[model samples]
Target: MTPSNILSVEAYFDLICPWCLIGKRHLETAIDLLARERPDVTVQLEWRSYPLIPATPPDGIPYRDFYVARLGSPQAVAVRQAQVIAAAREAGLTLALDRIETFPNTMLAHRLVRFVRTQDGAAAAATLVDNLFTRYFMRGANIGDGHVLREALAECGIQSPLEQGASVQHDMDWLPPLNGPDDPPPRAGLGVPHFIFNGTHSVSGSRPPEALLEAMLRALARAKQIATRAVA
Candidate 1:
């Protein structure tokens, strides 16, 4: 398939996951590199919903407890988090892991993303997700808080209360469930930052830039083929 015939790529992710932010940066860098190599290929990016730790309480869990419970020991958790931070840096993302105070439920954030999609489609959603990640992971802001989430949406040019209202109304229908009878079971119950490319290719975790670049290129090719067949 030719570059010109390639359609957009949809990325499913959540803001709270550190790996998701790293993966996002890698994908963006890959897209930039691809653009330089193949100037004619226009890849529109679409951000979809995939919440991590969806059943988290609204008030948020203590970061230390959460990490220790997941990683066994406080020291081990710190080491693991440090590894993620180093990886994020290598991916050109500055993550201030020390500043994160709370691990709030991301349901509201996901809902807000759905709301943005209605107004500006996927582009706005992408912007919002990027901002939220930067704010939460890099700057160590409380993304679980309604005020912070609202402000982040506003930064992306969305009206706060109105958008929130719309999101609340359509949250169940628009946003994908984390886990329930209605939710589609993830591929092997994958974690956050899981990416399904063109509904065929699956990539999980914070992959390197080169790997994501290859995935995107492959997804683009598959998309082009499907589009051409449809037209034919």
Candidate 2:
């Protein structure tokens, strides 16, 4: 058995992305598997905000129409959504895309998550994340609505004073623009459901649980090597 070590993981996601929810499920499974295989290793996970389309209006646009236009036609949209549904099913998720009516601007939602993390904790924020995804995809709630967000926050037991606003206004202070020229390739054009292990190894897209577990092992091994070299 290896000596104890802590593995840090950062997950960048957008609330509106179905794959983000699916990827989150896989990551949880991977974490559980890692705990069984390497009891000596502890995982520290943090969720980061990455809005796919920041330009989306606060009120949002018609969800089905948005996809139809983006994917060229309703048939193409159907095909793409079908693929998403199949992938989600594999992760034990059932996404009701038909229930969704509006494609919301996720900026407010992400800001609220940060706020919750600050006021409560990571676990509380995580619960809010799950609630937000479920509300939008499963119940077809327009998450961009302040009322909707407040309802989710209440469900998470977050009693922050910001509850009245339903939106947190940190002004994107923590994160830099995704398209910054200084960023590297994948970082610049990174897709949602991206994960970084130990701040070095990265896995993009909604990969399988096995793949995530392998990445965690690799990150742990690298951390061990660095510690060994430091002692030497």
Candidate 3:
């Protein structure tokens, strides 16, 4: 319940996760729909960082091997890869899994996002985020690499030095929704594409844009009810 009836939508995710990228697209589409359908509703979007693998070195680990260990076998990895590729296509995203040879730590990437979001604005942060996803997932660039991040920042019109943002900490403690109750219940996990709408509604994983739009509507309705109660 913001002063100006601003609706808050937070996407909790890690950059290295492919599913998160798909989820991001769905959220973005939902944002567009919300803007067109309900122009009266003001929304605030935040991209919160949640590193999936904190143990991986900044240099990154072998891409194939990392999944092979996590998923159990090469065949399993192939199956998952195919599944992700299919899902990505449906979302209008082309993922070059073959180009991704290494899985680098995304701590610094998260830090950069934090800096850009706080210093610049949500739109600027989103452009940088989208650029990073395109570079790493589409072109197979190493997002964990400092040079790669610098290039991404430059492409997104961020002239800040990469050296200024170098924190790689992983903090995944659960807290209430972004715009929900006065006291939010704690929740924790490593799920990407997790969306919390107005702290009143939350949907996890890479769902369809329609589903996200429904959640947004529910959140807005809830906000209206809350505001009504506040005035009464």
Model 3, stretches more than 4 Å misplaced?
Answer: 1-5, 162-186
lDDT of 2 by residue, 1-232 (tens): 3332888888899998999999999999999999999887878787887888989987899999899889999899999999999998999988899989999998888877876666677788788999999999889999988778778878878886554442433434442344245323345567879999997788988999999999999988888888788879
Give the Cα-based TM-score of candidate 3 against the true structure.
0.86
Scored by lDDT, model 3 comes in at 0.80
User: Which stretches in model 2 have alpha-carbon errors above 4 Å?
Assistant: 1-4, 164-186
Please provide, for model 3 over 3-27, each residue's C-alpha lDDT reduced to its tens digit, 9 standing for 90 to 100. 3357798888888888999999888
Against the reference, the lDDT scores of all candidates come to 0.74, 0.83, 0.80
lDDT winner: 2
Winner on lDDT between 2 and 3 is: 2
Return the TM-score for each candidate structure: 0.82, 0.89, 0.86
- Model 3 residue 219 CA deviation (Å) reads 0.7
Lowest lDDT 10-mer window, candidate 2? 175-184
lDDT order, best first, reads: 2, 3, 1
lDDT score for residue 71 of model 3: 100
Candidate with top TM-score is 2
